[model samples]
Target: MSGRIDPEFLRFPFRRVADAALHRALEHGAQHAAFRFAHTLEASWRLRDGRPAGTRSTTTTGFGVRVLYDGVPGFAAATEVTAEAAASAAGRAVETALAARPLAVGRISLAPEPVHRDRTWIAPYERDPFDVPAGEITALLADYSGRLGSAVGVGHTDAMLQVARETTFYADTAGTSTLQQRVRVLPEFTAHREDPAGELVSLRTVAPSTGRGWEYLTGTGWDWDSELAELPMLLEEKAGAPAVEPGPRDLVISPTNLWLTLHESVGHATELDRALGHEAAFAGTSFATPDLLGRLWYGSPAMNVTADRTAEHGLATVGYDDEGVAAQRWDLVRAGVLTGFQTDRGSAARCGAVRSTGCSQAGAFDQQPLQRMPNVSLAADPAGPDTEGLIARVEDGLYVVGDGSWSIDSRRQDFQFTAQRFHRIRDGRLAGQVRGAAYRSTTKDFWRSLEAVGGPQTYLLCGAFHCGKGQPVQVAPAGHGSPSALFRGVDVVTTRGGAPW
Candidate 1:
């Protein structure tokens, strides 16, 4: 069942503490201030060969204050939940900002945002995972693993479940106050096989991590039983499959694999911070520079993409960002041209946008918010073909599914991605499974080669729990939805020996 805000979080005197902190920061000569009280719960369980390997649970609660003094921003956090502690933290933040003002590069100016009073939002999820009995969850996972273990030629099986609940109370000097909670879970299963020659191969489930709850693992969202039953067979086939003969060939990429390509190429590249060189220390700057906006032919005319924080079941979905900017949706690429950039308050103002795109986010209460990615996704064709149809259109190519190892250049332009399974397509049909296959290309060249895309019926929402960025390192969850797509004359490579087999 869909969950409401946990009553325990409401019991915390967050509002009183936030008001006290804001009052103190303003009295300390701060231009802008924000207070965030956050509580997070995380649990992880792992199983190997039908037995529990480990299980762990963690809970953290804290509050942080951010302030701008003389155009410098500073932050401080504390685990204490008292108004006095909040005021002290705010005072310290102001002091820190004042000390750094002398050497600050430029005056901090934020984009204007309308005040939103007393707002609350909860992510769509049925059945809180934490409320479920640990024994029951473990039993289900073990049963799936046991099934896989019984498959012929299956050497071993591994399964994992990760769930998180995050609650935040945000208040700012601008009169915006919001209480938000979200739940997300990820379940994964893998089967391995080894041939007599000692060559090892494995296949993993395509079930994606999502903004769901315990129900997701209970066959509410994904078919765990069917996927688990089929994984061992797929693994067996992959182990005996021949290595791919690499060359320029057509490729039909499924949503399972294409989501990650979109994440690295379009999602990160379109962040205003990355484009303006402010985020180059951790991840390299983007090739999609601001100057190229509205002029660069980013892909084929059929290509369109959008950055959305309000997408249903999106991991990044929220009522408002850490900066109190409302969540939004906007086009980043339209008709194959660069059109927009994801932005936070400062970046939005620097980029001449009237308001932030709600891209600012922090991994936890103790961390400062950074310009992070939203749910950037490719727009599916309204009346395009299905996966089978897309494959049929390819005379000779490879059908790639499930994300595996990936490498992208600093600029997010040149890259290569391998998949969990690769099926050879010959004469407009799937020939057989192929191993050691990867596709490599420049971002623009790769997207521009898109010859067709499947319809909405084939679209899938997929994402990762850890997208690492920024100095001191922060991780954010993001989602990407894409339909099966066909690209022509792409560079297909054999990754095993760097030679065509």
Candidate 2:
């Protein structure tokens, strides 16, 4: 709630535009209206080998108006920030709603919510990444890449850093208003080496982006020095190791890899809109239909998941969603059964829920908001063992770290995932690094195979930007938290189609 809020958060004429837009919408016979504005600044620096390869930055600003007119919804947006433009957009939004009323699927019924007033929420941060000098940013990237490139067998190194600051304002005719700002950063490094097979192999860092500022890159959340020093050795070991033997094998998956699995399988699958078959295309419909709510066994009894928007430094953490509903935490799975879904005010009402879970989000002012995924995470068992302990419990298996390429059906059921690095495990110990390993399984079968998870000490918050959805393809940021997990008898494959040798 307290931090260095970006000046751009308040520089816009939020109240003036909102008043004009709402007044006009009401005059046009709209029952409800909301005004929204957003500004985002993004910058990135990249290094190759030992020198700067590229650098770029961009800024975008826009405002939009939305209205509920005679049981239908309409939206319009513009780059103009004036009150006059907002009023015009409001009128157009009402017109759009009127035009669609005749063909509307069903009457819109939004869940009731308490009006929140005079609210200001700022993402926690110590230093602003944007405020850092460009020279400093490039110097850091170059230095990291150079250090890695100097290592033996390290033929090439790539380093990059990207930062973004998003500011938003919202005001609804229901007497809710919120101004918010968030800062996020992502930094990555990779090393390449030629393997004994004379094929180039690559390995990258496993650190995930978070809702933090410049401080994150400077050793706040991650141990950069240790990771950089270990990269070359890890890559060297991986390049010469044998290709994974494909078959059913016991596996211990690190949180770095598990977070993405949760994001794709559990997080996206449980969205109310997708589950109810009201949203589709960008991501396919969900198999967890309404009829299965509280009936489907999503996983083993060890699987417990929560959808939240208020975890510290979480990418999706916020005080309020685009719909003017307060952020909340709710169970998605309990004792391995479907318990709830991520919902917004409208989706909640449609699904017979009493209140919103505040999952609604829009990437920018020009886009229509939808019920998006929150920071969905698996809860760690209080008495569970640590990661090392989990590994010790595995007799013969593969241990995978970091996420790689993945694919799943639109139903979020059957899927395959590869990782940055995999190590063969024999007799409860890692034998050596292995190359070209991927795991394939259905969502239900995979989760059911989960035998145990590391305790809270092994949990990590990880996620990415650019979660894409909707027709025009709106992108949102999200987070997922998980612990090192053990899965019994999982199918493993070699990317190069190798057999046991």
- What lDDT score is found at residue 2 in candidate 2? 45
**Candidate 1's TM-score:** 0.98
User: Tens digits of per-residue lDDT for model 1 on 1-501?
Assistant: 458988889899999999999999999999999999999999999999989999999999999999988779999999999999999999999988988988999988899999999998899898999889999999999998889989999988899999999999999998999999999998888888896568677788999999998888888778888888788878877888888888999999999999999999899999889988988888799999999999999999888998889988887778799999889999999999999999999888887888999999998899999998899989899999999999998899999999999999889999999999999999899998988889999999999998888999998889878899988999889989899999999999888875423
Residue 119 Cα positional deviation in candidate 2, in Å, after optimal superposition? 0.4
RMSD of each: 1.1, 1.3
Q: What are the TM-scores, per candidate, against the unseen true structure?
A: 0.98, 0.98
In Å, residue 244's CA in model 1 sits off its true spot by 0.6
lDDT of 2 by residue, 1-501 (tens): 346666765677778988999999999999999888898899988888868889889998988898999879999999988889999999999999999999999888889889999798888888889999998888888788887899999999888888988888899999999988888888999999998767898989888899998888889999888888998999999888887888998989998999989999999999989988877777789998888989999999999999999998999999899999998899999989999999988989887888889988998889988888999999888889988898898888999999999999999999999999898889888999887789999999999998898899999999867688888888888999998899999999888844632
Scored against the true structure, residue 38 in model 2 reaches a CA lDDT of: 90
lDDT of candidate 1 at residue 124, scale 0 to 100: 88
Q: Which window of ten consecutive residues has the lowest lDDT sum in model 1? A: 492-501
Model 2, residue 464: what's the lDDT?
67
TM-score of 2: 0.98
Q: What is the lDDT of residue 314 in candidate 2?
A: 93
